[model samples]
Target: ESAEEVIGELRPLLKGILREDKKSIPDMNEDEKIMHGCLESKPKHIDSITRAIQMTPGKALSVLLSLELKGLVRQSDGKHFSLH
Candidate 1:
């Protein structure tokens, strides 16, 4: 088969597999909740994230630290955070 034909044939199967994988992904946890509070492409202040997630500042900071250590989040100067 030509490359295009092979890709066309595989496209549906690949999409199905991706759908299954997405379904299998577990729900967000504590760190994920905090991460979700921040914008994916923009940094947000710690206070804003905390309030957005409705978490205590201390607890949000703790979870943010965990996310940072796990390489899922990046912290900029002045307590700003965004998805890494």
Candidate 2:
């Protein structure tokens, strides 16, 4: 078969695979969403996450630690946070 024909046949299969992958991802809680949004594109400092979340830096750090425990994020060099 031509490459175009092969690609056309795979299109539906690929879409199914993508949909399954989306379904396998677990839902996030509100705190997790707050942290997730702050970590978009690049890692962030404690102060930065606090600013984005509109909470105290200490409270933001607590939320970040919880997210880390949930396997949704990580802290590096004891300063920055990012998606895992």
Please report the candidate that would top lDDT against the real structure.
2
Model 2 Cα lDDT, one tens digit per residue, 27-59: 777877767777854677888778777888777
Quality of model 2 by C-alpha lDDT: 0.79
What tens-digit string does per-residue lDDT give for candidate 1 at 1-84? 899999999999999999988834335686676466565768899888877877788888888777777676788999898887
Model 1 clash number: 0
Give the clashing residue pairs of candidate 2, or none. Answer: none
TM-score of 2: 0.62
Q: How many residue pairs clash in each candidate?
A: 0, 0
lDDT of each: 0.77, 0.79
Residue-level error in angstroms, candidate 2, position 43: 1.7
